[model samples]
Target: MSFRSFLLIPLVVFLLKCAGSAEGRQSGIFLPTELHPDYPGCPAVDSSLYYYPVIGILTHPGDGASGRLSNATGVSYIAASYVKFAEAGGARVIPLIYNEPEETLLKKLELVNGVIFTGGWSKTGSYYETVQKIFKKALEKNDAGNHFPLYGITLGFELLAMIVSEDKNILEKFGSSTKASSLQFIDKANIEGSVFQSFPPDLLKKLTADCLVSQNHKYGLSPEKLQNNEKLAKFFEILTTSIDEEDQVYVSTARARDYPVTAFQWHPQKSAYEWASSSKIPHTEDAVRVTQLVANFLASEARKSTTRPDAQEVRDNLIYNYIPTYGGKAGKGYDQVYIFT
Candidate 1:
């Protein structure tokens, strides 16, 4: 054979080897159904001792430290506190980084019973778009029987509202204009005394008589604008009227308005500035109560999924003790007990 024929022979062998390697990789991708391990389902139980796993996602801070910081103390610290509170009542906590690709993040989400969206600096343009996309996808899966619970803090709370409403206007109304340090309140008048009122009667009662909400940040939701925004109007309607007051617990923050997702313009995790500011700790009791309430809410949701009736009473007790109490001068008795529902 000529030199050309020899070269052709080697090329054919090389192609054959490459084909075999690719086929092998393909086989590794799909495991056999029988090879997958299956544990016995959880037996029916009447105890509150059972535990559920919860995952917390950390967002990228727009300060160019997208990958450097996983826990922005203010966000992570509060989240960790909540996780500990949840564990005290029988729930496992898992912290996950949110910088992964969408598919990988979704896979990680599947492993946890619930999700917590931590607060951080907001991104710009396509970055925000991608972030919103992931949230929307997770919500869709959750609604479609995935059974995963979701909670957001600060910026995460804003994202949650945006996702549920699917209103891009959220960005235009709040995102584009407000600075991180600004605080805005919901304008109750826009709702025209409807259920969508910024402060529903129940929540208004809590704020006026029960809790002392602070105003620290520069930006917040304007109840009037939120109610007037044609798209958001419906969401506010559902959150106010449809969700049962007994099923939902509202927390008063250092901000305005009443809604499902409890949001605080001030960082409760900032123990120094928030608690120890002025040679005396401020709102320490309130902070502790907020953390406990969050933990209790998560535990209650988990119990519902596990069908553990024994935990119901414990859950009710928690709500009864923690809900804010009304009476006396507003914001005068800064007792932690007042915030406990």
Candidate 2:
């Protein structure tokens, strides 16, 4: 064979090898040799998990609705810490003003992936009715296979318990206000499918060993009451308990049996966000981590939501449209608050 023929033969073989490599890559049989810090295993992106999820936070009545932060009447407010918590978990927030018209509130629900019932003092009146309506809406969304989730904090927790039990008097008074407490896990406690599932083993242990979370509510559900109440028992399982100042054992955390609903009788956001000197909020590294991981769990659950609304419409209703008042400077319970009349 001629020398030129031999060179041509080598070039043809080289082209075939390159084409084979390309085909293998297209078929996902080939991966990059270089490892990136962000993509350590070069894992495929999960298109099913939404990266742009929006969470709706329901507003509470009064200025410092939970702690007497402000005396502003005819106004509703959402603590900035709650907003920060959602954002920390990679989710944007929209305020679901509790006192808004039923039509407006329902419309806003359609635009969100998840909802948060904030801590507040108002457990009765028009606010209570609004919460009931929204809670049912969330359940309906889940029933329709939308994968929507709800998080209830403090008063929010009490509301969920009351709504589920259909008994407004389900909550009993406990001297847990302004206290730093440690969680005591219950027997057969179900954490495997909860926000605590994302918690590191060490942190989970510390939750029981140390006072890593804060409690500042006047009312809570006892373990016995939760089990005996047919409705609450069927809806939520007690996850953790804490002793109040009066030596009363109350449920500190609980998770829904079937739905993506979790409730906290303590303030998980205070550790990392609030700087109120009056609070017994823990600021240790582990405490801050508890706040972060909880928020991360919320965002993760929201990512599973099937509702993907128009971006422009979401942007218009975001919490950013309202400015946060620096309530902390005035010695308010919250550092910042988004007040709406």
Candidate 3:
């Protein structure tokens, strides 16, 4: 070949390589290697695709019938509203079963930027054992320079507090009230200092004023319960509190002192996805705004994470392709319905 012919061959090869990489990405077959620093919290915005994050929801172990025909064993029984709540902020929520090995969970954590511990009456003692390890893993990831976030809802909040405090009695029955309650934020809860920093004053007012949050639990940590415990007080910064419909007070919400971890005692999803008339879940304009605001805040935090999913590893571990189980009052509120494996 002539010198010009040799030069033409290199140019052709370069073009082919570039085209192949682009096609692989579009097919979700290949992930590009992008340089990212290991940092905690939300990382600087550079990967636009990751801005719309795929959040992982840790499924509680429940072996009961969900409905007449529907039942679940592992991570199959996620609430429709929890999915809706996440999607409100333009994020997709996937189920992550914790029965797997520790290595498996670490890999799952690496795939997603943020994770949520959904609310339910789970085997607290055994469950917290797994959560403690995952919590430590997330802390390690953040310490090593990776931005990872964790959110606990209702039972999740209780579990988080128990793990952080190592106090099983830190949680107690709050008269087992399931009725809605108004939230009262501590003086420190606001958009400037804590998780509510991006939240609007009017929205905060609506959450407490309209009583949009759903309280369905027999046990919770009261503010007094937290203040008296040295471990809990030092580990968690109480963000909000509320009195149950039965007049029993509980710590409504909290955040970690130095991590992107937040916990909520109320179900923000109920007002939007739960349409069970018998349950009396709120579904008003302001109620939805509450879900959207919380969703957006979590999604924004997930976006701060620079962790990208592995093409082959993600397929082998997470990402279950299943048919949608549409139930509840209005049906599942979120899009991208997934099936259980």
Maximum-lDDT candidate: 2
- Against the reference, the lDDT scores of all candidates come to 0.40, 0.88, 0.70
Show pairs that collide, candidate 3.
38-145, 39-145, 39-146, 42-304, 43-304, 191-196, 191-197, 322-339
Off by over 4 Å in 3: 1-49, 63-76, 188-193, 311-320, 329-341
**Worst 10 contiguous positions by lDDT, candidate 2:** 28-37
Give the TM-score of each candidate. 0.48, 0.86, 0.76
Error of 3 at 106 (Å): 2.5
Best by TM-score: 2
What ranking emerges by TM-score with the best candidate at the front? 2, 3, 1
Q: Pick the winner on TM-score between candidates 1 and 2.
A: 2
For model 2, what is the alpha-carbon lDDT of residue 219? 93
Considering only N, C-alpha and C atoms within 3 Å, which residue pairs clash in candidate 2?
64-69, 64-70
lDDT tens readout by residue for model 2, 1-341: 99999889988997677657855446444444423345556568798877899999999888763535556566889989999999999999999998888888888898999999998788899999998998898999999998888999999999999999999899999998787999988853467889888888899899999999988889989999999999999999888999999899999999998899999999888899999645578999999999999999999999999998889989999999999987777564778889888
Candidate 1, residue 326: how far the Cα is off, in Å:
37
TM-score of structure candidate 3: 0.76
On residues 188-262, what C-alpha lDDT tens digit does candidate 3 reach at each position? 434354567876778877766777777777788988888888988887888888886567778888888878888
* Candidate 2: residue 328 Cα off by (Å): 1.1
Tens-digit per-residue lDDT, 1-341, candidate 1: 89999889988997667656856445455444435556344657766433544443343432122212223432212223334444654665443444446676565555555555555546445446655765665556555655444555556655555655565446322222111121122344443422223333554444334322222222334445456666555544322211111222122131112322333433333332232122222344443443444456555455434222234433432223333222212322221111200
